[model samples]
Target: MTLFDSERPYKYIMDTSSILSQKPGETHTRLVYKSQWERIEEYMRSHSIVTCSEIFEEIKDKEIKEWIFSQQCTVLEIDDDIQNNVRKIVTENPKMIEFTGKSGTSSGDAFLIATAMKYGLIIITEENKDKQMKIPQISKKYGITSVNITSLCEMEQWKF
Candidate 1:
């Protein structure tokens, strides 16, 4: 089912890097950083969410994985449909696809983009890189919106 099929319709796709940045008890400023996963948990309860297996692997910390599992987030698998779609994206965007060779196409970033495109969902990331190698570029190319974690928190009025 598509993301929009849900009653609330999940508006963001969580990436592994974003998840990592949200670890509880992690220090940022003088205070311990609050878990963004908590925000995600609430979102999932009201809307549809999607993530990749690669993201799960990236969160190797047992604590984080267990938290993710407890949240019951949907784990997207690499099936023929996603594979074919990735192939098409690579073929269509040759310049961007080249970066996949060095950094690898099986990256969680690539999977996030492909899944967002397939399910028509927006991407939420913490990266500020403006280069074409970034997921924001791919999201722009596919007409999908992406925002940083801070912006997302602001949008939801979630204060840390």
Candidate 2:
């Protein structure tokens, strides 16, 4: 069975950055405002889409991790297929050169995008750069739609 077979076909994919925003932390403060948290909860509960464990590690907030587990969010498993796809993206995407610079995009981000593409999922991220420097750009290149937390809330009609 597909992940969203019972519900609407899963259209939304969340990056660690987007999911991690709901958790309290220094970066979390800047990631998303307090008003968005409620909507995030509502959306997750209603939609059944969520970030993977790699995303959890990037979050760096214990409370958020606990909350994620408590919510029973589906944890994506990284297998050979996902790893191969990530490698393919890294090798093929020229923009990745400029985007990551010396450090390069993390394996987690690549895996997230690859998994989304493989499953035909829409990515949700906060990075606003127009180019393919972030997941949004990569998603765009792969023809996967992407949006921010606030936009998602609006789409879902999630009210505080």
Candidate 3:
């Protein structure tokens, strides 16, 4: 079953995995290599797509980072409400947060989910739903809809 409703003008909160995914065949990476960035740019400009600020820290590609910044998408700040929601998620599922081999744990996944919870938006993530301790699974557990990049293209009927 599809994660999203058959509604017009869908809005989404993107996870870092979705943004940086490089799935083989008809994926964003291939699209970008084919000089189809304009299509994606147009789509992003037209859609109500946003992401958490932590995506910046999670994304390792400098070019993609610059591209995202240039797209002018709404970068949701981790305010008190989002922080509280993240805490709740972490408390309930301690395994959701991963250690980044740094001083603190990686909060991108939690923050992305929390942002979606706060805004009541669907989550766009490349994480497999079958995998444990992943965004899709955790999102499903929390009653949130999560779809992959390919699903997003299909749902939106992007003719590319």
Tens-digit lDDT track of model 2 for 25-122: 63446345666665555556665576655666666667867877776666677777778878888888755545444543555677788777666777
lDDT of 3 by residue, 41-148 (tens): 665666578788887678877877887888876677898988998999999989777675763345788888887887777898877789878888888878889998
Residue pairs clashing, model 1: none
**What are the lDDT figures for the candidates, one per model?**
0.67, 0.68, 0.74
Ten contiguous residues with the weakest lDDT in model 2: 96-105
| Model 2 residue 95 lDDT score | 56
User: After aligning candidate 1 to the native by TM-score, how far in Å is the CA of 48 from where it should be?
Assistant: 4.3
Off by over 4 Å in 3: 1-10, 22-27, 31-39, 100-105
Top candidate (TM-score): 3
Q: Which candidate number maximizes lDDT?
A: 3
TM-score against truth, every candidate: 0.74, 0.74, 0.80
Q: Write the per-residue lDDT of candidate 1 for residues 1-160, one digit (tens) a residue.
A: 6554555465677886676675544322213444655566777555555567766775668977887778777777777777776776777766554544563343566667787877777787765548676777777887888877677778778875
Q: So what's the TM-score on candidate 3?
A: 0.80
Q: Per-prediction count of colliding residue pairs?
A: 0, 0, 0
